[model samples]
Target: MKNHNVFIALLHYPAMAKDGKIIITSFTTMDLHDIARPARAYEINTFYIVQPVDAQRYIIQKQIDYWLSEEGRKTNPTRHEVVSMVKLLYTYDEVIEDIQKNRGTKPVVVGTDARPYPKTVSYQFLREEIEKRERDFLIVFGTGYGIPPDLMATFDYILEPIYGAGDWNHLSVRNAAAIILDRLLSRNRC
Candidate 1:
């Protein structure tokens, strides 16, 4: 069976700016390609790109259309496969609704961040929870500074931030998604 239980969303709206204001962040075209590759590798069947602007959504949809087209597939079949998993939505609520419809149950919503939240859960705990395969999970990842504080509070579980050897902590959303997926779903994890 397809592993449609675990989903990841890349949110462009309601993200925090450096000035600490909620804003709709601009989409990075390559983020779709980079993040979708890992989502496919991890057997995650649905990848959500949440953007509220109509024009931005149109541009993204256009790119998706081309990738799903036969000509684009001829150019790169692997990309076509990866891009096929993307589901465009306007709001975070819509993402939840879609997952619920697919799984027949409300997913245990999880949020990702570079900072710790009161409800933050360890990767080990989440990995084991996902392994149970009894409940669906939707991991929400933000595009700007991070998901706003008010929005982050709504998630059921906030994953502990990924930390490297050094003090620096910022990671591109695409890289973060791959590492988080490997940690949660990889069979050969050490």
Candidate 2:
């Protein structure tokens, strides 16, 4: 999805920003409920990179329930918006192919903000450069357990890790995307 449209969706909530680029943000496992709305808003254009599991049906059902609940309704007009926003579900090979397709042509920024590791530095640098140039960006998230090492290696940058204030173990993937989107939007003046 285009970054600007994602930014506008996020702005629907008073807490999120109203302008600029949008990147992915993570939510702690426990706070998935809190982050669901912002995540749905950003998911309009953001790619959700999840692990391949046998329980895909169950997980998708749970996600549907989460999106249709009161919290999701408060943030989005209807569940279909969230359902339609999900664009791709890929294995590692597909992700590699997707990256290859965009390399050296359009600016593609990948955000991996969930984990903090030096390995993510290179991608992070590349992402920063893409943003500095005001180009198109793409973000990837990993689910199931965590992002595979190989996929993580493909990110343009790992977000600067932040410690959550609450009891949550870590930010949920949804909230993490919101944070990334928030930062991206903060960068644009238009």
Candidate 3:
């Protein structure tokens, strides 16, 4: 498994390239401060908010257990890799408030893995609209019970869901964050 200390260090310094690109990592895990760090980094940020009903210690423990399991060990490998592998999870309301607080004139927020799928479209359209207006982008994902239907309706996009090939869902979030960060960084190079 990833060394907890290394994961904490990455959270301390989320890689930000010279261009105006930002990557935020989050999960259904215990470190809220780590998740919030990225939000503070980007003028545009993404969040994974968990539903109130599912914000119990048991769920967090489950995530922790998954992190320590054999597959988790394989995925994280070492402490230096944990920050790159997992996201710091947050409560739904906390995410919304953070977005509202950090959202500037040009901000986009995406709620991924939402039900009904249309929310994803909304996020895309919102991005287009924000670009048209020359605004920033802020995206949010839902964890635990997932985003509510009403909130999902307002998302700028819905991330394509990736079912684990027999692994835990939490791992999917970590992998997604890494992929997203890679894409964002690559595009920024141009």
Candidate 4:
């Protein structure tokens, strides 16, 4: 299994549209729930939902609070265990800072895309690197159209796109993030 120091971020702000503008997308409650459960199940350290909008962030937090409440916990005990791992942060800087403080050093920022990118690395190599435990990693996933080009440049390495059987190459950010993490972390399954 990959080290638990690795984190995942679901980016909502500083993302892109089809046009050349940076936009803040709204949160999908289901995606937040779906992603977080799998993350905790897969033993990921933390799941950060990076949103700049206060209203959107409030809604997300409320949902999290519900899951953490006594009634919600009684309803689904395992889910409560996982949703507890979700952290709502406003900026990339907060994620970076938190990782640095927790890991006691800077992390290797990795970005994911639906298309090929420069400095793309293979999953096997990334998995191997994770086993070395030399550094922590934060893998960022974009929701809307995709991650912005400038944002892509910030990453130390971009993971190659997740390919399907055909040329069609779109997936819910939740599914993509879960699949990517599973591939990188699953030991016996692989």
Candidate 5:
């Protein structure tokens, strides 16, 4: 029996900009390969990219289809396995519905941010809690300055920002998602 159920979500709209404005960020093509690799490696059940734009969604779908193609499979067999886990969705609610349909339950929504905020759940605590419950989780990564306050308010838990050697806290969402999975899902890599 599987003891863990985890999903990854990338929120492109309803996110923030450096100027503290809410904006729709463009989807980064590299993130499909970069982030999906970590999601597959870390055993996440689903890698979801939530973008509402029609053109952006079309492009992402095409890319995903390519990765599922014979040429894509021949180009890099390993990445093909990873990309197979991706699911393109239009919004957060759709993600919930998909998980519920597949997993038979709604997932607890977890989020991450670069801002140093108190009352954030520690990675250690979250890992232990996940081990204790038979619950599913949707861990969301923001596309810009991080998901805005209103969106953050909807998360069941928000993980604390990861720190580097200096005061630098900003990390590309792809890198941040990878680190979060390593810290929370795997044998302590630190």
Candidate 6:
């Protein structure tokens, strides 16, 4: 498929904790590698790591910097390629600003969640929407429990939950991202 103006934003701040309190989630190093791989495979424009904490952002930036360095590239060229597409930012606003600055248009923010919201759209509908490619698309994924309800209300669309054959639906952010991307961009019927 042709490269789409699609970006992935993995948010770590203002996420809902298990206790229903808003908290900042820790950035996972594994998510950086796992999410970027499928994103690159699907020809996404960029993969953004959104963390508000300075320490967390710094740690992720260090890893990104190393991966783009000569030694890291020499050690793992494949990883270097994927890491090159990751942009670490301090807030969700920065993500939108960066994309707007680069793309000359604000992206259509699509939120991913484990539960269906009133604005939830099907995978097939979203697939058709992004395929239009009239505007940039930013697929947002939350860490910890999930993005809070108030924040989710501002998103352009919330994708329907990825259900399985049974009632169980919890999925790792990385796995959900890969599955969601495939469902939206894959050649086969979803």
Pairs in steric clash, model 1: none
lDDT per residue (tens digit) for residues 16-90 in model 2:
112322222232233333344454544434333333443543555466566667787777655545544433332
Query: CA lDDT, every prediction?
Result: 0.92, 0.44, 0.40, 0.88, 0.86, 0.91
Q: Which stretches of candidate 2 lie over 4 Å from their true place?
A: 1-36, 39-44, 49-51, 58-76, 88-90, 95-115, 119-135, 164-169, 186-190
**Which TM-score value belongs to model 6?**
0.96
List model 3 lDDT by residue over 53-98, tens digit each: 3345456446556656888678765422333333333344454454
Which prediction has more favorable TM-score, 1 or 3?
1
Pairs of residues clashing in candidate 4: none
The clash count for each model shown is 0, 19, 21, 0, 0, 0
Worst 10 residues of 6 by lDDT: 1-10
Number of clashes found in candidate 1? 0
> TM-scores, in order shown?
0.97, 0.50, 0.40, 0.96, 0.93, 0.96
Ranking by lDDT: 1, 6, 4, 5, 2, 3
Q: lDDT (0-100) at residue 43 of candidate 6?
A: 86
Error of 3 at 54 (Å): 14
Among all windows of 10 consecutive residues in model 2, the one with the lowest summed lDDT is: 7-16
Candidate 4 per-residue lDDT, tens place, 74-124, comes to 999988888999999999889999998887898899999989988899999
Candidate 6 lDDT, tens digit per residue, 1-190?
3656899999998799999899999999899899999988988989999898898888898999999999999999999999999999889999999999988988999999999999999988988888887878899999899999999999999999999999898999999999999999877772
**Candidate 1 ranges beyond 4 A from true positions:** none
> Which 10-residue span in candidate 3 carries the lowest summed lDDT?
1-10
